[model samples]
Target: MGDTGLKRHGRDRRPGGNDVARLAGVSQKTVSRVFNNEPNVTTDTRERVLAAAQQLGYRPNGAARALLTGRTYRLGVVALGTSHFGPSSLLVALERAARSINYALSIANSFEDDPSGLAEAVDNLLAQGVDAIILSEPVDDGEEPLVVDVPVLTLGAAPVVHAPTVLSVRAAEGGDAAAAATRHLLDLGHRTVHHIAGPQRWWAARERLENWRHTLVAAGADVPEAAEGDWTAARGYEIGKVLARDPGVTAIFAANDEMAIGAIHALHEAGRPVPGEVSVVGFDDIPVAAHVWPPLTTVSSDNAELASVGLNYLVDYLNQPDSPPAPPPKHVHNLVIRDSTAHPPATEKGDTRA
Candidate 1:
């Protein structure tokens, strides 16, 4: 029996070669070849080494192996701590993908206000020996950290750039979906669609606002003052009340589903008929979107796929550090047209037909 003190936290930290040699009655060097996947190890030797590893819990340290080979099989992710829809979803997806590829992920939460914080976080990840880093948030105007010792990749929340970055479903695409929602309202002949946008600091908010403006401009409709909501139903309700009182504001495009739900409640309390007096369209087809009284007509963002793509990209970089950065993946968004949107009221009276 090996000494318990040899392991830390009760984990078997016994050297694989020593355990393999003991079980096979061979030299430790022969065992090393088998464990390293090196050539020249006989099948019988390999089986003995494998058996010894299983008995001793002598798993190879991937990080140590990389250090020996000058490659680390670890990736770092920079995500925001805020509970916004896109960032949070991306983080969860990344965790799943990283595990699937036999790579570990080191995540760092960043703040939007201080863009420099990203570089600082990158430094921290580097210190932790991460092989590559993915920026899930936007890059601020600072000295670009593109050519770090390790490769860097980017997802949404950052502007599109032709570089080593890989983008997976960006806010701009989300904006396009928002535009589709606005156009759905326009097709119904609503004069204009009012918008309750999220906080400006988020890339999703900026992109959605831009799409809303672009859609209105194309239609030659007056874009009403957009109230800012913080991805919360409460803020949505507060902003919805203001839009509800306006006779011209017949339709609304909320940046997220939470806000959309709040907007629905606000409109209901103000006695405005949905799809009759005022139509509402929202982004992000969250679970609750389908449950609302008149289900929300919203765009579905595939965060799971997005996260998986990013994680795969980083893992590949770890395998082939010299592999020229992969091009950003094209993200597809589909609009789910539910009952939340319809013809805006011709006159600000009441028409409650489903």
Candidate 2:
């Protein structure tokens, strides 16, 4: 029992397949076959090899296997890194979908709206050798499309990457949703629907704004200048204050639920009752949308489904590179009518209800 050579070497050496084979009394090839799930090995032999691997704390080398197979089985995700509801929710769904397909996900955040930042992020992911890449929140930097060698999947309608393997899965058209919200307000006899728009750099925000304008024009409604917000309640509230003071502003549409909530707070502070005096609508029916005072009438997009469908398409491309590219599925949104919207105040019609 004096310092055995076996114990001394075991403490210092990293366990390998050879070590497991030695412990299991089998050839190294047999151990490798067992790990690789190749047929012809007896059940008992496989069990012994696995038990020996566990006892010795031996793990298969993924890098070695990847090199042999020429696939990393990893998906890289490029996101805006914002806490905004859409991007965050889509990321969660992407992770879950990747896991379900036995692939690993690596996420890199681009905090800036610069093309250089996006290029750097994509390069970083490529350096890590991901089999495929996903652009979760693609923004137009007013530059040429990004060039990538590997298969690329985008979660939105805009094509951010230009590659032979590029595929796009579209989310519900933001412009359509925005137009619906605006039309809802106008139909209620409001003169105009003011807008609290998200940052301009975001393609989603721009689409929402454009659609709002287009809808107003089509209906011959006044299109007031939109107030900009950074997708925050604070910014929404700041915009809200100005809107509340305007007696002609009887309806408002925010780009997201957080901004909508902030607008409601501003209206309350200004003694303007929601639905009674000013109706508010928002995009992205967030979880608290139904619980807020007066509740929120908003457009609900299936963000999780968008991620799942996009990831599945990427996986299909990975498995079948030669298959003719099929058309990407369209994501749809529904408008949820809640307590936050109503007809314009009756005071203008000389109908008073105390």
Candidate 3:
């Protein structure tokens, strides 16, 4: 066995490439080529490398691989630190998609309240040498966009950063989802559909708000004032209480399922049976959407598909800069119709189509 005696640390340290090479009776460069799939190593050599790795419980060093290949093969994600369903779901999807392509994800959490946290998060990811940065659950602080050096992809919001390589998931999808939800209620004979919206600072929240309003205007229905919440069941309950007091409010649309469930509790407490007196609709058909008292009729996002498509575009931009970008995936803002929504009760005027 030939050994170059290339050691990065002490003998007692966790096994690294050097140890794998020594134990497998192969050169360090051969191990690198095998791990990198350079296509020159023999099948016997590859099998020995794997056997040695399994025996030594060794894992490939990302830093070492980056040094050898000149690419970190890491995807960086900048996301809000909240557990809000929409943002959290997309984050999980991004992790899955990145792993599917043999790439790793590094994440930096930014607080929604701290507007400057965006810059700091980007800086942290940049120091990590990620091939691309994904801005997930972006917020609108009314500040100018940050200038970034690497490729940027936005999962929910449109691109908020100025970068050499730019990619975006369906920016119109949120608004389109909102339109679908609103139209569904109006079509069911509701004179007017009230809204319980998330904070306007979030791009996702704003998208739902603006689109809901637009939908109302287009349907020629009376547009009621949108009530804002913190995307929690508690906040939804509070807003729902206010809407329940109004007899004219026959239908309600909450931005996310948490808020929607909260609103349902409020209406029930106020003696208004769901879809009996007040039809309700929610967004982000979460796991518990069906289990709730009355199943929630809400807009469902294909989070996994959205993440995979965005990652493909980012990888494409990195691999083939000269080629035109691939066409973005077409997603339908499909609404899940459940028992929570129905035709409004017949008043003296009766059920009228919008």
Candidate 4:
């Protein structure tokens, strides 16, 4: 009988340990070490073994290898199903970074508002034997972390269920930025700045709302009741039309770029002159941010950088499981001032109430 203790499944023709040893001209144990990436093998031997395995089309079975090394070498990402730019971009960045570090990724997109779906996605990733899970969803204050056997990482400011967390930016910093934008409008002498906020459940949205509120309050400007949207251009447009009609809204800070674009369109449709009558600011300086009639002034989340750092942190964690918990991932945010924002026009100076 063949030396492989496992039988090949139908049409699942992948070369195994024995096959790797035969090609590498070494014992199966040696091939096993090489495949596991264990240390102490001579460099020359490791190179030869890797070349031979590559030539023979040997692919390590993650499940079987997990049995041997106690690590799946697979990372899991739990993402939100919405096509919002931040979550989608973060997932793509994580996948690319995972590949860069020689790890495989398995992802599941969960609906942000569905608790059961989130639990199911977590269970599925665990079932596949992932080493850890990175959650891109904003933490649900009402929910507990899905009880899992693996480490869980939450990527936003909200308190996730007892899991390690990272944030895109400090809520305070985002608040500060919004306040600064408000101050900018204030300096330009607008009566006040109105907000088009994102979904209430999102940590980023909550934080931005808080900051915007604080800034307007500090500036002695009447902060209007914010309208909520799901961070879609369509929703932004809808709210934009409402804000456009008010005429008292001298300035606006959209929670994200797509919404900002929609808001701009709504302003045009309502016959309000942008910047001249209503200055606009947005968040997440996505590529389209600049393409709007006036290039957008917004913030950058450095999402790709966030992904790279998270993957590198996980790798380090894997290598040293005994180490104390790692510090939370650092989130960088910067303001990009472009053509979109300018001093509010002279007409709306006295009317702060909206």
Task: Please name the candidate that would achieve the greatest lDDT relative to the true structure.
Answer: 3
For each candidate, C-alpha RMSD in Å?
Answer: 6.8, 7.0, 5.5, 6.4
lDDT string for model 4 (269-329, tens) is 8889787678888888898887778888888777778788767766666666676756655
lDDT of 2 by residue, 1-354 (tens): 122124544476667888888888899999877765555789999989888887887877778768875878788998887888888988888898777555789998877456666777788999999988888776666666788888888766454567778888764455368888999998888878899998887778887898889989999989999998989999999899999999988999999999999999999999999988999999889999999999899999887777778877777667667888777777777889999999888676664532
Give me the candidate number with maximum TM-score.
3
Once fitted onto the true fold, the runs of candidate 1 whose alpha carbons sit more than 4 angstroms away are: 1-60, 112-116, 139-149, 159-175, 321-323, 348-354
lDDT of 1 by residue, 113-189 (tens): 67566667767788888877777855353545344465667675564333343435454444467778888888887
**How many clashes in each structure?**
0, 0, 0, 0
Candidate ordering by lDDT (highest first): 3, 2, 4, 1
Worst ten-residue run, lDDT, model 1? 160-169
Better of 1 and 4 by TM-score: 4
- Model 2, which residues run further than 4 Å from truth? 1-69, 113-115, 157-160, 172-175, 349-354
Candidate 3 lDDT over residue span 103-192, tens digit each: 799999878899788888889999998888899887765668877898888766553578886777674544489888999999888878
Clashing pairs for model 1 are none
What candidate 4 gets wrong by more than 4 Å, as runs, is 1-65, 139-145, 163-191, 218-220, 348-354
Q: Between 3 and 4, whose TM-score is larger?
A: 3
